[model samples]
Target: MANQVVSLSGETTQPSRADVVIIGGGIMGVSIAYHLASAGVRGVVVIERAALGSGSSAKPLGGVRATFSDPANVALGKRSLDAYKRFGEEFGADIGLRQVGYLFLCRSEAEVLDCEASVAVQNSFGSNSRMISGAEAARINPFLDPEVLLAASFSPQDGYAEPSRAVAAYAAAAQAAGVRFLTGTEVLAVETAAGSIRSVTTNRGTIRTDSVICAAGAWSRHVGQMVGVELPVTPVRRQIGMTRQQPQPYPEVPFTLDLSTTMYFHNYGNGMLLGISNQQAPGFGRDFSFEWLGEFNAAARICAPSLAEPDLEFGWAGLYENTPDHNALIGASDEVSGFFYATGFSGHGFLQGPAVGELVRDLYLGRQGFMDVSTFSVTRFHNDDETLVREVHII
Candidate 1:
């Protein structure tokens, strides 16, 4: 179906109808809009509660990698990385995509084996990831404290990008492809009748649409509640801290992940960007805490001594729309027809946003996506299927 969204002439006038109404102006929503438009779907309207890319997509440490424990995630990573590589030429935007690679430091024999196993899976998917000794790891990233490391997995194809810029690129491309964007428009409620999406009521006005894709990121649960669907998605807070630019220059190295402590760091400008995962008491708290700084510093001292400096120049927090299994909920919802989801990516959402958009576009248009998306369906939780693909290499 070629859906065309009628462009709004003025700020007060809302788009009365659209083929597809996508909520959220972040990377996921914008990327989906772009893909759908590029695929010849017209009348695609993206509703953003705020300006584009201002949500969780803006707060990431900007790490993009294919070094995942799950094959599904690895495949998605590979596809997204491919897109990021050509993003500059394709989008006419420099997303600062640097393929400096990703180095994961393991501290124990068991962790070493786990790293080896993940690398094996990653390599099978053409990731070309390999295990390196502590000496080699230090050589790859000289800032690492080599004495405490057992081994590390390095994938040269993986790296980071300017996430906000990437979001802008997708949004611009979508706009140019005839996708209408409704910035500052809040989806008040998604109205349905006869078990199918009828229209979406927004703060501005009503938008009649056949399909509604909830790409609302951290606010997806609340959005799902509008249709009486209980999405198993929660917003977990994650924080990142940056050090003051050093007077002495540090070598630009690969983004390093300390597996044992869940602490990771990489070169950002002349300083370093670092963060850690707090599994306990994960909630909707987006406030940066000094309490966590102490823990992050301790981990940094052990893993990367150079980043152990007490003076954290600045820090911020963002929420990850996480699911129980830490995998994304892609495809249409089983409960409501025409209601689709491309959210709940845990922390990997920003990295996988583009590929996911393309995948969703494929499924929506009744075409085979780049990969099998059966593993990411929303019905898996409904079918009482307990054997979910649990991602091990998350930080």
Candidate 2:
């Protein structure tokens, strides 16, 4: 089954037909489009309501890691991490990937146990993650308060990258391979018949296609409803703050995270970036709030006391497409033919995007994937007896 997408003079005009209509021009859509096009599939159209990588993809300084307790997540992160390392070589894009590693601070005995367990799983996958003492953590990042830490987990391969660069790289590569992208085109509805997709209606025009890939990120649930599929994804606002250039030059440090509160900090430019998980604030609100700063500062005081001294500027606020288990929703729908999805990755989407692209390609081609994607099925949540998946190491 071959597909084709026709483009006019510029990228603004939407093609009336395509082999595949991918909703979302973020990391997942671009990656999947690249993989599909490079795999000899054509007529692919990626529709983004905003500019490429302008959504959640443009937000955070992307973190790439494999230090996860869940084996599937570890594999996905590991695969994507490997891809990110070679992104510059393959895609001709310098993503500014500095593999300074990830350091997780644990404050209690139970947290230490969980850290050890997570490291054990990570090491099993050849991630080379290990549990370290508070002193060792302090040695890695001098800004830390070593006196209060119990133990920490460190993975040398885990690091951060420039997301916009990666997104541009993938999108450019995909587009060069004859993929048409329609930016500022919102998907209004998905017309379906006989349990299969017919066309994807957008604000600009209609794209006639049997296959519709919902890579809509935080807005995935609304997209799912258009096709009578219930994608259990909720958008929760997460924020990060950046400190102005420090008076003293800051040393390069690992992506350090406090285990209890999921508060994290890493070296950025002359200063650093800090963030915390605000499970209290919910919804699609991308508005930056000062209300959460007090809680973040409180956590930073116990985790890394020195971070409190610097005046931090509120950074970007993006939505995390959360599921009940905080994992991901990836798979083809059984009921709705030609509907594939790779979304709801919580905060691990950027790191896992590459591997997920491969997974989605495999699913679309009816081939075997590198990892068992059975656990990531969208139907798992509906099964009462099923044990839901959870990615414990979140930062």
Candidate 3:
């Protein structure tokens, strides 16, 4: 055991040297570690300030979907979805994956048109998503009132999984592959020389490495600043609630989301899991509040008028590593040699972790990645608005 961090095993003696040091022990970090080690890259180490998977990656019910307005995001999400389907076989970890599907409810003509275009984009990428009528949407989730919906989009391959379980699974497999975990080790500085990563100085110890990957989740901005890289990631709080089980089991339904209200729900235990983006939610908060419940109730009454809000006895808050356009930032840094990052996924990090890990690994090894991620580079923010990647179908 080494540096134990919150419900995690103690770490071994801190390493003084490594081939690569990844900041943050969340999904992206663990996934990159596992993928790199599995690819025969040795001497990889991951540093986390707190317990692994204790960040946004700890969100219990994480939705996984290939449904997106942008084709690149669709590719990333779809590839990761396929990887997650085989996680049990490859990583020997059951992530409680359920492909109950995702249904996006549109309430306005503009929303319906946008959803239709999004579905078209998804279908162009072989996602198998399609536009469905309000009646068909009702059949999938009886809780919704069809009369209020203009139209909807459905993706059968989209669903939810246990985020913490997936993170643990990847961390376990990575450790088994000889990847070191420096839990509770806060990164103080990313030392560089002649515009290249030399080592990382941490609270516990310094690890000399030629390469560094910043996957520090919501705190990625600070990590980037330490290396003179502008990561442009802002932390925004998002919350979720679980209802007390009911007397009778509710019928299983797809993870249903109302685009207009940014409210969503899915089956959880014998009741339901509810979540809604707080428009007035300030950035960077640690505690969950009942303040958002009023907004949640207002949206609930409109989206699912028949369903009563169950005794909301369970809930938690987590941050979203948001970027200006709500698209992920994943690429190697030209300013700092041997520096790579995959952050600012907004709310899509967990679903895209597997694909992003492989991309970063290829970039590290100087191999051509499966997809052209030049569009995701941090350098894009420096150029015109047209160069930046924007995702319209985000929560």
Per-model TM-score versus the true fold: 0.94, 0.95, 0.96
Model 3 spans with C-alpha error above 4 angstroms:
1-10
Candidates 1 and 2 compared by lDDT, better number: 2
Clashing pairs in 2: 4-43, 5-43
What is candidate 1's lDDT per residue for 14-36, written digit by digit as tens? 68999999998888998899999
lDDT of 1 at 269: 75
Candidate 2 lDDT tens digits, 1-395: 00111222454478888999889988899999999998999999998887888778876487899988888889999999999999989988888898999998899899898889989899888898898889999999998888999889999888999887888888888888998988878889999999999999888878899999999999999999999999999888888888887678799899998878888889877878888886755688888766667778888888788887558754777888888888899999998999999999998889999999999988888899898898898988888754664654465
Alpha carbon deviation, residue 64, candidate 3 (Å):
0.5
Index of the highest-lDDT prediction: 3
Among residues 3 or more apart in sequence or in different chains, the pairs in candidate 1 whose N, CA or C atoms overlap within 3 Å are 3-42, 3-43, 4-42, 4-43, 5-43
What local lDDT score does residue 197 receive in model 2, on the 0 to 100 scale? 98
- Tens digits of per-residue lDDT, candidate 3, 48-106, equal 88888888888877899999888899899999999999999987888889999999999
In order, what is each prediction's RMSD in angstroms? 4.4, 4.4, 2.7
What C-alpha lDDT, on a 0 to 100 scale, does residue 68 get in candidate 2? Answer: 85
